[model samples]
Target: MLRVENLVRRFGGITATDNLSLDVARGELHAIIGPNGAGKTTLISQLTGQLLPNSGAIRFAGREITTMPSYKRSALGLARSFQITSLLTDFTALDNVALAVQAHDGHSFYFWGSARNEKHLREAARSALARVGLGHRADVVVSELSHGEQRELELAVALATKPQLLLLDEPMAGLGITESARMVKLLQELRQEVTIVLVEHDMDAVFALADRITVLVYGRVIASGAPSAIRQNEEVRRAYLGDQHAVTDHA
Candidate 1:
């Protein structure tokens, strides 16, 4: 569970997040949707301790983590998958996840043995890959992976930490229809195991995966509710979903 209260962040004269307040319940999937420049990423940065808020508070699992360092936050069960793929091009997918597992297991400083040779680390890494449906591609180099596989790898790395809350930023950004559907299925399966705070432009995925949705515009929360409630909200229609509806009708 996480709680963000009256969070505000600014860049020079611009306000990126304006007193944003929200909560993610234990084991719930919460999605934040907004147009470009809506400050969704900024809010995530603050929550993950990548950026300090101008004011307000962030609490995770009952402790105030607003001022904790990023690595410390990760150690405390907060893991994130970035919007862009962050992987080692030369490393095998298994090696990449193994490093994550090593980091989580407090053995990352060991350099004598190949991470692959450490059975405990390898098993942990393989389990994470299995969770993301990437077990078969463990030995493949990241450069050889398709875009969708890379995305799944990102999720696997995050899962290697055994996070209580997973913060995902646009996991479907560049996927084809089938790939997106695959991602949806994987996320749905993951929902039963971890709390998720998803930030995505894919409305279908958001609707299908999110237990609740929060709409952000101009760096402020415009709406927050269940899928059905968000669909029927007049403010949400005028501020965000109107264009989506028009596109859907034409399609």
Candidate 2:
């Protein structure tokens, strides 16, 4: 459903993404793993139109979206959750998601009515919250939410867009063990409904959830295969997974 071909992004003397190429089939959970500075976030930025590539192409479904603006990309059924929480601190969780639903519906100008009073937008937002297991917290202020709840809220906000492809950037980051497990479960559930491109540092979660894994080192893809193959790849072992293994063993 998504295709990236020979994508490159450079900043002066440094290359962030170097000729990276990959495809994500419909309903597949594709994970990208790499050491720090491997250009994972850069690749995402290019794909989501937050950063235009210096060269190469990105196609979603069938059409090329390399130069499409970020809002246009979002309108075309692509959604992303950032590594950092991007919720509005003062807004209620439901209000934040309702605004997202309203934005997609092209009705952002409606200012007077409580966004919560718009039944369709409210229902849509509530459903998104329920999907992320946050229905009960819908009325709570984002600032009052725990870190894990905030992460879930991020996913809920993304889902409010009804995206066909979900780009997740380290959904498990900054969570406690139980919270991480909860996120893994939520992501596993989401896989049944949408295609995912996961950029994660949690190897166990990646191995458990990814239908396929791509390994990146120094802004280049060094390996791409199934979980088992990725686990055994020498280059991956030498670059990232070896460190992952050591951490796992010590833990």
Best by lDDT: 1
Q: Count clashing pairs, candidate 1.
A: 0
TM-score: model 1 vs. ground truth: 0.95
Query: Tens-digit lDDT track for model 1 on 79-116?
Result: 99998999998999999999998888777555835687
Q: Which runs in model 2 stand beyond 4 Å of their true positions?
A: 110-114, 243-251
Task: Write one digit per residue (lDDT tens) for candidate 2, span 125-233.
Answer: 9999999999999999999999999999999999999899999999999999999999999999999999999999998899889999998887899999888778777
- After superposing all C-alphas onto the true structure, candidate 1 shows an RMSD in angstroms of 2.4
User: Candidate 2 at 216: error in angstroms?
Assistant: 1.2
Worst 10 residues of 2 by lDDT: 242-251
**Candidate 1 segments exceeding 4 Å error:** 110-113, 243-251
TM-scores, all candidates, are: 0.95, 0.95
Clashing pairs in 2: none
For each candidate in the order shown, give its overall lDDT on alpha carbons. 0.92, 0.90
